[model samples]
Target: MADELKRRLVHASGSGLVALYLLADYLAIGLTWQYFRYLMIVLSVGVIVLEILRLRVGLEWWLYEKLTREYEQDQFAGYGYYMLSMTAVVLVFRPEIALPAMLMLALGDPISGAVSDDSLKRVKGPKVLVTMFVVSAALAAPFLSHAPLAILAAALGATVADGVTIRIREFVVDDNLTIPIYAAVLAWLVLEFVPI
Candidate 1:
């Protein structure tokens, strides 16, 4: 029971980062895109420095241990990937594509992660997919002109990305990074080709 509670807290805490992403999206409308790029760069550098200090000097030892995955103790944590991926999406894609994609990652991935088991025993589990689709679609509705189809495509892509775990040797790619990129690409394709 305690373990379950701890897990929920940790996952929920991670999900809280979504608020920051959403804030960025909101700010993007008013600020120049270049401002976002610079902000991301500063954030990335700050996170990297803090992470290095934490690992090397044992800074904020208790908080770090509590928040970090066991596998990430010796490596950069999910936060790094989150920032990197968010930056990539903002920089690589147009604002229209980037915002929905970030929203899919920010909202949908967390909903799926909180509820679903980590195992791939069930390929593209229904619960996670459905939750992701609903959350992504709802969050994306206001921003997107053709909300239904574009949001559906983004949701589907996010679900697939979240469901699959990619690894290169010892490094496991976090869903935070993959979900937005996949969703953005898929959403963009749908928006471009399909007359919705």
Candidate 2:
């Protein structure tokens, strides 16, 4: 339980990226979107390199033992997926869509994870799904209040992504890589269409 809490805490800390972007833009700290974008790219690349070393070259880290799951011992860890998804959203979406999307993954997913019951060995139940939607919607509300449709779309996307766990052969498709990307895409679609 303590380890799970630590992992979730680390997962939630990913929100710092969005917060950093906001502070940088608000304070005119010269860490504009251009620099932030490059930073994400660089960080993603670094993560890929580290993942390769960890998975292929037998490299090990202290956090790897503490934070990784039983399934991650032989595959890409959630951290890699997280960086990939975050980088994807930052690179592909506008900040208006990307920041809230990232926030949903960072805050919403962890909150849902905390309330989930893996002992059932099933997808999250309705209550967990509802919690995910609520947290995601609240997170996006501040940024997307202007577009209620977009806000709902984003919340639904995040809830679905986080609630449904899929596996391909031996590899589990992680919500860390799906939640933000799906949420951002849905939000962008609503912003583009729906006659808002």
User: Best-fitting candidate, measured by TM-score?
Assistant: 2
Residue 114 lDDT, candidate 1, scale 0-100 = 73
Q: Model-by-model lDDT, in order?
A: 0.71, 0.90
- Per-model TM against the reference: 0.77, 0.95
For model 2, residues 1-196, the per-residue Cα lDDT tens digits are 8889999999899999888888985787888887899999999999999999998999998889999988889889999999999999999998889999999888898899888885433478988999999999999999998999999999999998998877789666889999999999999999998887
Q: Which lDDT tens digits does candidate 1 get at residues 1-196?
A: 3444464465445334435555766756544667766776787788789888977887776766566667778777876777678778777877777877776765667667677776644255788778887787776676675557887787778877887677779666788778889888888888889987
TM-score computed on alpha carbons, candidate 2: 0.95
Instruction: Candidate 2: list runs displaced more than 4 Å.
Output: 26-28, 119-122
Best by lDDT: 2
Error of 1 at 15 (Å): 8.6
